[model samples]
Target chain A: MLKKYGIRKGFIAALFLNNSIDFISIFFALIEIGATPIPVNMAFRAIELDEIFSNADPHAVITEKDHLKVIMKYLSGRIVVERNGGNFLMRDSGAGGFGRGPAEVDHSIATINYTYRGYGYPLGAMVPHIQYLFGSELLQEAVRLDAGERLLVVLPMPHIFTLIGCIFLPLIYGITPVISRSRNPLRLFETVHAYQIQNILAVPELYELLYKFRDSAGDCTPLNAFLSGGSVMPDEMYGRLVDEFDVDLIHGYGLTEFTPVSRNIRGDIRPGTIGMVCDGLEYKIDPCDEFGFGEILIRTENMTKAYYRRSAESRDVFQNGWFRTGDIGRVEDGHLIFKREKKKTRKVKGNMVDLLEVQRILMEYPKMRNAIIECNDSILSAAVEIDSARNFDSEVLSIKKFLEDRIAGYKIPKIFSRI
Target chain B: MKDNKITTVDADNLRESIIKTLAVIARINEKEINDSILIKDELGIDSIMSLEIIANIEKRYNIQINEEDTMNITTVGEFIDYVIHIINKK
Candidate 1:
């Protein structure tokens, strides 16, 4: 099957797919054949998609037929492989072969997952196969989920949390990963009950909805543990999940650069803290303040050395064999207690929204002079300085309309004001 | 010109337009959207998508839908009706 598509060693393929068996199968197949697969965010619109293609420049794109209309223009001369049964429909734009395949082809790097640095464009984190192989085992030791247990995977698979915690970990640990298509709360409950899922690793936002829907529906489905990560789990929310739902909510922390940096121990659980750093990983708090809080730095064997195609930014984060997490925290009783992000980032619905990234895109507005985006009370709003000749009302609408096309709907600033 | 008042004819037209708009945003066939169809459960509209839908409607109609109004809407029919009401009030 891979032969027919001309997918060979060192071939770079972009997977623009949802959470399904096909996504996993394609990913594994690419890895098996020594190819690098980049899992694209399903929510990405044309502009986001274009930015990724421009950077990664994958030889081919594997996506469903529904997304064809949106990505057709970006295809250019690349191959488009549709996940349609036995007969794979491959579209070639007649611009010679696939593409100028990866020049050097560093075999150590497994997958290049795109992530934000709280500013500028997103950088692709080049993780190796060894990381998932080893990190999953470390995570398994912490979470302690047995093989054959059904693990509900409701989050988007492209993100590091879901990719590692849900997909890779399950695959490596021999656990059953049941991927849910929708983030709808009722549907999530339905999937949990229907599959008899014993475990779930999700973001805080889903847990919040599950609590709401579970309470309203009066569901009593049994589960082993609710593993929370991707974003900081509120102390109150953590308490509610454990006390109200009567379930153990295991909270952990990590980044796309490195998976499972730290995870709470199974028996020795803490409500707010991210718990001990994962075994085999080294962590240190640099520049400790008077209150004992500082930027958490992690050095792991499995961590990515540099961001792919981003030398300067990668150099900035990676220092002396340690990855600057950009997360402020302090060690309390040997547990890594997260304080707050030292970077210009905010979590909206558990997804990191880069304020600088938004501001950078806002500056692209032809009418705009300057823009500042900030999140207050969990609501993202932007204050802009535009030309005085332009009507404020029309410019706000135009800027929003411009942003809606570039970024995800959730990342869009809700309120706009002229400065 | 923006219409501040929606008459009976205007309301009907507006409702149809909203249904069409939502169908496109939700990526569902227009025929599939009905009164009983659950917005979140059936259409798979999350908080983000819901906000996007409201933003699109507000942009088109030049009207604002508050957070409270958004909370009150659950079904496709209710959302269409609420938008129509808001348009009428506008």
Candidate 2:
């Protein structure tokens, strides 16, 4: 089908669809054909999708049936294909194709992983296939996921956290990952209890939802350990999962450019720190200037070469075989301590404030669904989605006090509105 | 000197091409559309598709349509009028 569309080697193919078993085959097939795959987040609305389409200029776009209509509109003068997902993935290509050893499909540029999180324009890092192998193997060595480990994957497929933790790690260790198409939290918990699943890897939000409804688990649950990344786990939730719920929860660190960078060992961990650096990678922190904080940089054996279509931008960071992560952190007691994300920080009244740090603190607040802080035209404001559990006006009042208590007054958004 | 003649083209001919293109885009027949149809509701012309239709019109007519004007034209008939006005102005 790609050949019919005139997509040759060294071309870019946009993978704009939700998570499913089919995502695995389509992703590898594109890699096997030597074309780089750019996995577009399915949750992006029109404006966000428009930004990515212009940024990556793909030769062809493969999307789910429902996403076809929307994705086609964004693509101009481009080939589009639809995938039905799940069992249809295993069905023959209808072309009756040929062969290549899975291990031999290495060292080629695999994907331009879209890792941007801020409200700004999307940016992708060019990751080679070797990075995927090294990162996944590093995880397999640390976690020791046995062949019998029944893990349920809940995070979105496009995220680096999910790709390393759920997909590649399991495949490398000969463990079968239970890929669920359902997005409902209830169905996920049901799958865990019903399937006798052992391990879970998810973002902090999903863990919080399960914690909120802990009674749903009742007495008998098959879950043994939980691994979390993409964000720091709140202390309250961490304690509840470990002390009350009797599940092992560990904090891991990863970025889209390189994943499974560092993950806490099963039994050895410390609070307020993202675990020790994984094998085959070295990390360092710059000397603090007038403060106990410095930027974190890493020299990895298999880190991405540069940003896609933005070589000059990468030059500012990738120098002397060291990649400067725009993350501010410090080393304390031999563990990496996260201070704030540099990209999301803004200067307010001569003080630097991290929007992501504020968003993380505001997300788990009472009656708050989600909080997004953005700097638009040099003005910082927060769009807080208030849960309908309480009166809208009253929730706004409580949220102000909540922000005042947790963050600096200058860091608080000048305008707060319910989304 | 007489070679530059602005031959007035047939309005129905241009309108026919527009209708056919719209039918192909909406995946419906030209018979289903008329002067009173709301493109947003009847044809499901989403925001991105609206830009796509504008691009198609520009390609087919060999002319450029102002994007700002395209946003305000909601109905199918209005889109046709906007294209005709741009061509006639030339």
Candidate 3:
């Protein structure tokens, strides 16, 4: 089938699915054609959309009516397929329909992914064919996803972490993926219960929300495993899920540059650690202090060839044929402990303050579920979730006093909130 | 326009203005506002608090703030300074 579609060479194809049939058909079509299919995130904002479009520059884009205007703006001169009375490509099963030809292609640049990093860069990173193939193999091994396993692709498809880790990885093993149209917590829970989903790949945000919803609903259906990423999953929340839901959650760590770099798939789940490195990936820790934790430099078969259009930035970051994942982390007892991103760290009153550390501390409180710490020129502020029963004044005072003694005075949060 | 004119106060008044604004926001939202009140901790402001505070300061001072100016605002004092900077820029 790939030989007929002229996709023997590397080509980029996008498809919009109205139902499970469309999604499955496209999956088979792409694999048959040897073309790498890039899934556009439906939840992406305008800036994110612009980045994905500009960076990917896919040969063809298939989208629905709701996304026509945005997709058209990005794929102005490229071939566009409209689906289901929408400005998207239709799923063609016959010969010469969508992908039905072979061509010589560059094996280096096959798949492109946009990590939702606000508005800075459109395409966060690109994955070459070899890397994508290698990533699929490694992830399948790490997560123990086999042909018989039924997987749930609940995270946004546009993200490389989910696309490769969950969708493509499962597909490679011949496991069918249950794709959900919406990400609403209630709907996601219903989908899980209805589909009897054994494996799930989602962000920590989604997991936390689902955990809360499941707690209130009182219907606890057993799930084989849950995979979380995108942001740090607090140990407190992890404990809550284990204690309440009796579900073992695996934490996956990777960026757009390298998908599924490290993961905790087996037992001895450390709350904060991202787990051991995956196969075919080599990692080195350049610790700033004696503890051997400074910068995380990685080289893998799955690393991107380059960042599109940002050659200078790419050159600066990609050193000695290794991608320097701006994040600072340490390896302890065979587990990767993420400290903070180098760019986000601030020097407050002569003390190096990791804002992520502050955030983790704020979120540690039982009353606070999620917290974001933002620092400006002279002051630091924290946004925290409030327990309904706690008094705001007392909570704030305790938090302030706690930080004042533990951290530097400058690191103390001047502004506090439950918002 | 004349009636809408707000008096330009000193740095002390600017600081007080920010505190008052925060207090008013807490009262309106039925949240407890105190010196150490975590803006997102007591209420559920999220990222919108940054926008709301910026908007309130703009309305109160009749000044415009750019993205660069907004970067300095984290605490109440810095937020007041941010407003003053915008006021001076205007």
In terms of DockQ, the best-performing candidate is 1
Where's the lowest-lDDT run of ten residues in candidate 1 chain A? A212-221
Worst 10 residues of 2 chain A by lDDT: A96-105
TM-score of 3: 0.61
For candidate 1, write residues A1-419 as lDDT tens digits. Answer: 66478777887888877678888888889888888999988767665677788878887788877767767887777767876542357776666245566534589999989877775577888888788777788788888888899899887888878877888788778889988766555556667788888888888877876665454334545677998887778888888788666677888888888878888988989878998888888889998899899999999777888887878989999998999988999988878899788888777777777788788888988967888898885568899998767777656656766886677666778778878
Q: After superposition, how far is residue A173 of candidate 1 from its true place, in Å?
A: 2.0
Pairs in clash, predicted candidate 1:
none
Model 2 ranges with Cα > 4 A deviation: A1-7, A85-107, A117-119, A219-221, A290-292, A345-419, B1-90
Could you give candidate 3's per-residue lDDT for residues A108-182 as a string of tens digits? 666555432222344445567767677777666666765777777865555666667656687678877888765
Deviation of model 2 at A192, angstroms:
0.8
- By TM-score, rank the candidates, best first: 1, 2, 3
- The DockQ-derived docking category for candidate 3 is incorrect
**Residue A67 local lDDT, model 3:** 58
Model 3 residue A94 distance off true place after TM-score fit, in angstroms: 25
lDDT of 2 by residue, A1-419 (tens): 55655555666778876777778887877887787788876655444466567777676677776666566565555555667743222222232222211221124678887654342445667887878888888776656667877888877788777787787888888777887655344456668777778788877656765665565555535667787887766677788877645776777777777876677777777767787787678888765656657888888868886776666667876878888777888777657777766776554422335576667667868767778888653346789887577776456556655664344444556556777
DockQ of each: 0.06, 0.01, 0.02
Count of clashing residue pairs in every prediction: 0, 0, 36
lDDT (C-alpha) at residue A224 in model 3: 70
Cα lDDT computed for each candidate against the true fold? 0.78, 0.67, 0.61
